[model samples]
Target chain A: MIKNQFYVISLLVILSMILVACSGGDAGGTSESSGGSESEAVTLKFFHKWPEPEHMEFYEFAVQEYEKNHPNVTIEMEAVADEPYKDKIRVLMAANEVPDVYFSWAGEFSWKFARAGQALDITDAVMNTDWKDQVILSAVEPYKLDGKIYGVPMRINAKFMVYNKAMFEEYGISEPATWDEFLTACSTLKENGVVPLAFGDEFPWAASHYVGDFNAKLVGGDVRSADYLLTAPAEKLFTDPGYVEGLARFQTLVTAGCFNEGPNGISHSSARSSFIAGKAGMIYIELEEFVTVADGMGQDAFGFFQFPSGSGDEGDQKLLTGAPDGFMISASTEHPEEAMDFLKFITGPEMGKEYVKRLGIPSAAVGAVNDETALPIVVKGVESINTASGMALWLDTDINIKIVEVYLPGMQAILNGTKTPEELMQEVHDAAVQAQSELSQ
Target chain B: MKRKFLNQLTPYYFLLPSLILMSVFIYLPVVENFYYSLFRWSAIDTTLNYIGFENYTRIFTDDLVGLSLFNNTLYAVISVIFQVFIALVLAAMLEAHLVRPFFGTLFRNILFLPSVLAISVVGVTWQLIYRPDTGLINQVLRAVGLDTLTRTWLGEEGTAIYSIIAVSQWQWVGYCMILFIVAIQAIPEELFESARIDGANAVQQFFRITVPLVRETTLVMTTITVIGAFKVFDIIWVMTAGGPNHASEVLGNYLYRVAFRNDEMGYAAALATLLFVITFLLTFIQLWLGRTGKEN
Candidate 1:
């Protein structure tokens, strides 16, 4: 009896231990799966469309630095190409798998994502922060929708003419101050066998960008007001007298044979290359490209200038077409607090200044930015944004993206002479109205 | 009775997996896509309202849609006329008595190399070859002192579509060449020998013996090419992005833009439905042609 009882006790103890071991394993698995204490270490997935390794390395370095300072948080960065990144983000948004933090252009389409509640609300954090007062009002305001901040603005890019200084000097032509002078400059450049302006319409967005910047001179209006002014019923901005005049000016350039052969086929990189190589006289580039273009052309070749204003009847040059890059937090992020903390770290004065210094682009931060390669004229272009009475966001970025994807292609057709400008404008207005109704519905 | 039961069940058992796959991949999506076509939808729209036929009506009236369809048809017709006809002629030439002994195999393989490369690579390679400034074609033209003939091949609206088609033909003509070669080779040796014995020349034999033998291959190639031409997205998307103002726009790329970019899922689905109908009708016509020819 004693032996049998001892055997039974031994068997029971072994079985109990096995049960405990299995349950322990299950608990560990469950913990890991449920984002429990051990798995609670914050991981923020950050996505951007810029895939340059050097730029990404800086981002990676920042993430590591941020993590060293904040032990509980980590950031995973992914840089995807342009079209693919947009599609990936859209799919992720639909699937509720968006990254913790992602790059965004501050505009209507981007705002749609924020409005749909897919993005984390950072209004309180951004507004109440001491640094809020330091950020330029123009840059800071666009990221806020309906009085709620959705993203932190990174940089303010001013639209301007970026010329090859080497090419200009070689041709012995000074930078022009007025549209007429600009036209004459283009003619002079063309006469010298240099392509005047290297533009590509093959990518429909390029034409829209140029058109958007041209419209800035006419509207000279606030972006929000411009949006309401253009998209509101019975107010077709594409057909506005100002828009027509801009179109005519644009056409004069095209008709003068100012642009390179197959301008439509020339890509951004190639266009930049042409200007850099002294193959083209001019290209309209955003201010952010100042350092990048200099780096690409090795500082000796490239220069910047503001787009020459027209002498024709128009309001004082109140508005500059602009886009502010921003960062957003994903609503579905596993670590919202950590993501917000990362945003705070990057948007701070030190990082912003360093980024601006590295980029030669102006920052939206209230902090002083040191651009070591300071082309005074370029800095002047950047400073003009702060001095402008108002700013208009790029039309494609400001309006519903439906308008960009649909109507912009039509604009390309008008520019290509495949469709009449009137027809194109009419179709675009219809599309804009249709898009508004669709959005409202 | 047991043997009979096993025999009857054997066929179904063999077909069961494939049937399941078909239901999952093909039929299920067909049903779902059709249902999705009836509703207003978007990537993250929590609700999709049923708006019957509204999307379809919009697609029919859309000018861009019309342009896309016209371009797709144009591509198919041009590719068929040149790609198929030239492939047939080349196959006959290679299989002729003068070249057939050795050069036939060598030349066919040499011509078939382009079809082996990835479509995107082919598109990009041709894009460079047609580049306005630094491309090989223009360089050759300039070197030959024909600078006036040098123009932007893929950029101009006048030549973009044709240039694209030429690139596609360059890539796929090899595939058609192979198909035609096989068809020509399959003509019974007895028929050709008999024709030759009757004092028929090589060309006559080809016309009389090879052409009739290759009708089936022609039908098959036409069907495949037509389907492929309709579904072409990668070449155009990678090359021109249907641009210089939608000059090379095809139904496939246009459908993708409407659905993904514009977030008009319902309208895109409607467009897809029309595409499906067109493809189905053409396939039916091919089948009818194949059947009637066989019957006659």
Candidate 2:
């Protein structure tokens, strides 16, 4: 009798363990969705790229606020760094499995997902919102396709030549307006034991900024948009003399000792840290990075200037190099209403103010930033965006990802002096021609 | 008759799970890779253009492939030499009476520690050590006033590939040593004793006895290490990203960049297939050489 009782007890214990495991696995099911009183307990995935230590609190706050507002919805959040996120998003889309809401770059990046039937069409939902006009329409224009909305604008940025005010003052160098003056400043800075520019090319896109800036100055904006957008035929591909001239001028900067050693091996974050440490005289920074940088380098230390045209046509000086980064919902989301509502709440003016205040993101929502609470550098950033004649989309953003693969490493080749201007441009032109042929096929 | 039949089928039941997993994860992907390599596959859509054999033809014409193959071959040769020959020397040192048994175990564990580390950690640590401006190597060179010797270790085209190769050597040489130590320990005590009794010196005993006896282990270690050197990705990816204008582009990271960065999945698949064939052939050759030598 005793042996039989022991056997029965052991069997009961194993059954209990399996029962617990099954129950734990079923928590994500819609058990709480009877009679449509409070809708199904849906777990909405929120994925994004800002996984830095400081940005964690901002994301947690946003998710917690959304969950509190919608008790029936549970927000499952994930974040990755920028480069990994770029690769991960492609793999996710290729597999036909996407998060409910994810951060995406506008233009060809979002269009790839949209073309793949992975992006959600939020045209009607966006029209229903009251804050539609508050978003800078031009900022969100890149994400629009066929008169349909695919993303909500989360940030606006314009590139600037960010310099340490104290370093420039110590060197007695004002902002250089011409190429000669820029070289003079670089030489002076080097003489004083400071790196002239903290150039980092690890992302390679970061290196392409100079290429874009130089190309903007040399070839007119129309020519740039035509070739860089990869719309031109093989005969009219990136063979423009101005394109080669722009690259040669970039080589001029490298030869002039303007950049620190080993630019291609460094990362943008490390370069930024070096700039903040006053090891470098200047770095090219985006508007969104101003506040964090100012906080690190002290508010009175850093200053920014417009990208110098370097004795080129004055007409191209006003063109801003930037892109609209925004939040887009995927087609796989069951809770479209809840997701849109949450995005509206985040991008709305009230949350926009807090977003700008806390994270220092360059908010696209009107009244998100002001002269009072904003850093002085941010005030200048806002003014730069407001007064810009026209925005020139970043080449990596405007062009297809295929061409970016060529352009980025080509820039690296140019910087490293491994490939000449002619060689690099020929490679880029060939890549563009190949891509055009493929798309036509 | 029923009992005998059931007994024969019992071992297969135990192997079914592993066989199923290997087919699903490894064999299935490889077959799919081969199938996909024949088409012009786009990530945006499933519309594939079946331009048969064009992709393989392109691989032959591609200059990057030539460079990568040369690099991989060089890497395999060096890795085999270091991992097999050098590891035997170190293992013999520990095997002999010069070191205490307790010290031998300690040395073995210490040598194997780097292989236990995550690749990312190892790559980043090496980068810090190799950095031009604020690196330990450059700092030491400067301190000794040999500042001219402190050229960018990974920035210049000539040195970048070799520097990365040196790092791989540092990481795996010790791992191969452990395998050697294990094999050397397993050699019987009587052979060395008998050789010594015959008036053989330490050098003679090592070359005649220990060297020939551990030949099998050398084959195994060389096979593993050579294959490893061919598939190296993380260190190159993290350290230089095949940069300084593709100076350090290895086969593994090159295929990855082509696949994800260029969005040419078909071409990338073809590259992967070529790499697979190359590695497979190299391993087959190693095994063949081992068998021939053993027969001799």
Candidate 3:
């Protein structure tokens, strides 16, 4: 009888232990506090992608300042690095545990969130109010989807060919003004035993940046958007002859021995290092990376040029391959007002100035960067961004992710000499058809 | 009769907690995964369209699915050859008292050191060693005036999978060797003495005695190696991310790309189901073979 009683007691203990383990401990008891009055203490969970110390310093200052101004509101902040943050945010959204405010890329990345009703519609807060006037119009344009504002722009970024000034002077290579000149310069550098372009496609998104630029320039924005958004008919999706031509033009650079050998194996950072070390004469980099380049090769050692215009006059030659990264409020936030206030605060002129001063990137907030707050090259890059005909968002983020997956690998195949431009475009077209069907469903 | 019945009931009562925990955590998710595999859903989307077997059919038609399966098979086969067969041979050598007494422990420890390090650290270190221009391999090849023979070990499609597989072997061979060592040590010294008396040479004794004695360990090791090869993600993710155009893509990496990167949760779930079925069937076959061997 005693033994049987012992078994019962032990079983009960074990079961209770499991039950305790399985129970999710009160996640800060936020649910109860939610929907409370403005005077009541409320905690807003904030998430962003910049976890590196250099970026984190700015966020920490912004949060501290925001908290000081709103003592009743406690901000619980979390951050992850760029790549893993995408996966983490998706899981958070799926679990319906999205933070009050989170960082998001400006194109289809945020659009998918909007379509799912996860991103709050801030049309009134952004457009109806004076907030829209505070940011660069072009910077905020990508965040506006289907006539509704979904996100607030933070930093403006664009790609350019940053060249070594010394190497260019020695080789007598002036900033190329056309595709033919660019090709000639590449051959000249290659003949001189210098890597003409430092490129890496290990992450594949690096390849997508080049392709995005070429596609935007060759295929034009309207046609690319129609295919990217899957609004085009099945026969017309990604079937543009200019897309094939754009890919072929990219391939011409490859065949001319323009890029560093075994580029697919090298990482973007490594490629940047090669350019900084003067092993490569040029590198296609984003405006945000100017700080790193300036740090590595000295501010005076490099000069920037837009990728020279192609001979084909098919698309907007002045369209820059770039976008503004920004923050969005969760649609299901109980404290939409508080979240909006937080978004405005983080993306306001003060934080934007700090963003440029500390991060050396151009802020989307109007007049947030100048000679005093940012590097000379950053200021110049921003000027170019402001002057361009338009901005093309990063292809990997702008297009449906399924099609991007095919396009990325196909681009790598082209680099490896395994697939032709026409062949890859056919595969891309097929993927687009599939993506269109999936999107419709 | 009452006491026997109580005793039987007591064991079940003690097992109830574990059974419940497993049911909730493991069994429930697996069942739920199967149900999810039949739907079309994105991670963030609220809608779940019931598309019965469409994801499964898509899996059969996807070219990446075929390539990934082939890569996984290649990994498994190579792992079996190096981690199991070669490890067993090395263990026999170490146990046979062939090495100098002082060097035996030294060699074993040296070999086992890689397994002790974190896999991520191993991956990063190997990536540096395989780098194109400044890597250790290329530097050595260039130093030997064999520059033409030097290639980007982790970059080319022809070499990327093999390079990743080589890293796995470097890290795991020692672990398998240690396991075999333990198994070989368990056989009584008297048996070897008797075999020596019968004039059995070292090679003959290894084949005739040590191999037979360690059959159970070999089965366990092979099962582990094969399953582990199929589920390889971290090293590949850290090294090439199954890239140079998916040349090194295994089932695990493909599933993750579909689920997270592509945001096709249903399709990923279907891929997960296929992985589970393959591993399950392989394990069942292995266990059955072991049992039949025992019976014979």
Best candidate, lDDT: 3
- lDDT by residue (A59-81, candidate 1, tens digit) is 77778889898776666788888
- Tens digits of per-residue lDDT, candidate 3, B7-119, equal 77876775787798799989999999999999988889947999999999999899899999999999999999999999999888877855727576887888888999898
Candidate 1's displacement at residue B162, Å, is 1.8
DockQ of each: 0.28, 0.32, 0.66
| Candidate ranking (TM-score, best to worst) | 3, 2, 1
Judged by DockQ cut-offs, is candidate 3 incorrect, acceptable, medium or high? medium
Which stretch of 10 consecutive residues in model 1 chain A shows the poorest summed lDDT? A30-39
lDDT (0 to 1) per candidate:
0.75, 0.79, 0.89
lDDT of 1 by residue, B1-296 (tens): 76566557656654665676698788888778788899997775546889998888888688888889888998999889766888898888998877989798898988899989998899878877888888899999999999999877777777788889899898888889888998887777888788888999987987888887898888888887888889889899888888867778899999987777777778778888888888888899888888988886
Q: Taking the true A–B contacts (Cα pairs closer than 8 Å), what share appears in each candidate? A: 0.49, 0.37, 0.65
TM-score of chain B in each prediction: 0.91, 0.89, 0.94
Cα lDDT tens digits for candidate 3, A1-441: 888688778877887887777564564454545555888877889999999899989999999999999998899899999889978998898787999999999899999999989999998998788787788877878988898999998898999999999999998999998899999999999999999999977788899998888888888677888998999999999998889998998898889889887788888998999899999999999999999999998999999999974575678998889989999999988888999998888888888999899999888888899999998888999889888989888999999998988999888888888889999999999999989987876
Displacement of residue A350 (Cα, Å) in model 1 is: 4.1
* Model 1 CAPRI rating: acceptable
**Model 3 RMSD, rounded to 1 decimal:** 2.0
What candidate 3 gets wrong by more than 4 Å, as runs, is: A1-35, B1-7, B190-200, B292-296
For each model, chain A TM-score?
0.85, 0.88, 0.96
